[model samples]
Target chain A: MSNYSKVSEFKDGVKKGIPIGVGYLAVSFTFGIWAVEGGIPLPLVVFISLSNLTSAGQFAGTGLMLGLASYFEIGLSVFVINIRYMLMSLSLSQKLDRSTKVGQKLLFGYGITDEVFAIASTREREVTAHYMYGLILTPVIGWTLGTFMGAAVGIILPERLQVAMGIGLYAMFIAIIVPPAKHSLAILCTILISVGIMCLIKYVPFIKIGEGFALIIATVAASAVMAALAPIKDREGDAHE
Target chain B: MNKEMYYFVAAVVMALVSYIPRALPITLFTKQIRSRFIRSFLYYVPYAVLGGLTFPGIFYCTDSFWTALVGTLVALIVAFFEKSLVIVAAAAVLSVFLSGLFL
Candidate 1:
């Protein structure tokens, strides 16, 4: 009975992960093309996707590296861009099944991307290590495979097509934030504040900020302002509640 | 370090910074967060980060400003109604390709 249940849970997770895997294939393909176009070697590009499995962090980090930014800048930018995963990890830790082992938790914790966390946290039952593993498998494969394919194909892609595809990543970013911002005033304000800061740093001669530092400042300043102005009400399982 | 070596090292640094935030919280902390301010900051940060990265940079993505603008508008419209990442991305790319012919 235990074996049957575990198998079913793993299967369920794989089923849920399919759509996310398909999406990653498209996005990571773009990442591969962009990174290679920026002069990153094909193998290293694939390695970045395999190891990091993040969209924004990888893009920002690669952009910095191509520009020969300092290691400090790369580290700080990636950290700030990815710090939200910590919150998702915290939320997922509480939802993990009590029977899950420490080793299992640590291993699967590495797989907690935004999409994975969203699916795992919303499961009606406690998330099992098996389920997490199954959920991570397809997306990881898609991300890595897509990178490899894109890097290879990018070499032969025409310059005009490459330029057109340059808009792919930013377009995806628009797709991500637009729906939510349309629904919520706070989100709209957050986006506007960040964009305003970025513009100042770009156009204002006196500002003089590095690309990595600019991103960190904009992200922190915007998030801090929105958080202070509109604190979220405590929900169930919150310590204060 | 040579250029390739520096690139590899940078990739490693990025991987470490990316992994630590993800692994540490789940491995070390089990208790729910009590602070509303911290919770709210995390909640709002991703959107702000995405916004900061997209704009201005998106403007410079293509050869001409007009192509990028048209692509951005198409992405926003498709994403507003469709909500599929691939479709939104594809629509924008197609729009830019078609517009690039004339612009």
Candidate 2:
């Protein structure tokens, strides 16, 4: 780990980040159209793209907008959709440099999206501020720029095409979960429990609440149960430090 | 009362909501994790959350739940083979498009 210069490592991160950035362009393009077609102004769409890098939360926020939902509803939904980032960041914090400055930590946390979290966790060596910065740089730019272009020309796409592209987001989600779920029964159970909880909350009327609450409750319940019932033993070399 | 004002406000709020979660954990947790249970629980959060988000919602993405289900199933099968993101998404969209033609 000491052999490589930070510059080269950072460059490696940027290089690794390119494919993610390209993928972001496609998915965020769909997000852009979804927001814009829902009647949000182009500049506002651009503002959202620039300010918030979250995809699912942003999609849900747009829905809240269309429904003219209250500020509290919008806020709570975004919170619920994005609360998983907190978990991801907490998990990755184990890997970050101990001497990492607060400012750097702030930057690290700011970029803690699903893909960034996954990449940071799976990297072979310890994560540093420079590499993390490089890792997020391109994907962030790609995400924002894609949104701009999508909003600017989104009218070109037909409804059928948009609906078809909607699956792209779910495809990416499946790509992330399915591989790992195949490996571990705990993870498989977690997915099943979550889906079941969501179905129960969504389909049945009595406890059927807002989607935001349902999602948050389902996620928390499923993770808690799976973690307690089927805790994964740490593999060798999975040292905490 | 105008639509512009509402959207701008919503976007601003969304940005704040987005920033807090992403940044909070890094700022607060400067030490290593002490609890095995917490670690285990956190480990499953991503999987659980993704599953929660994908289902029910994926089924609702298209006008026809059946088409979306077929698409999601295609995505899962294709992803199991460890395909790239683009291919995964393309296979999903194609499934829905083809299904739409027949059903």
DockQ of each candidate, alpha-carbon based: 0.52, 0.60
Worst 10 residues of 1 chain B by lDDT: B27-36
Give model 1's docking category: medium
Stretches of candidate 2 off by over 4 Å are: A1-41, A59-77, A95-99, A114-131, A234-241, B1-10
Candidate 2 lDDT by residue in tens digits, A1-241: 3455779878987876775676677667777787888888888998988788878788888898889999899998888878767766776777676767888888756777777775676565767888888899888998888898888886334657656766766777787788878877788899999999999988886884776667678878998997788765664223321
- TM-score of candidate 2 against the unseen true structure: 0.79
Query: True-contact fraction for model 1?
Result: 0.75
- Candidate 1: lDDT over CA atoms? 0.80
Question: Per-residue alpha-carbon lDDT of model 1 for B1-103, expressed as tens digits?
Answer: 7999999999999999888888888778655556878777766766777788788898888889999999999998998895776688789889988999999
Please give the clash total of every predicted structure, in order. 0, 0
**lDDT tens digits, residues A1-241, model 1?**
1333778888988987775676676557778988998999999999999899898789999999999999999999999878767756765676666667778777877778866765676465667888998899888988888898899785324667777877876776787788878878888999999999999999999888776567678878998898899866676432211
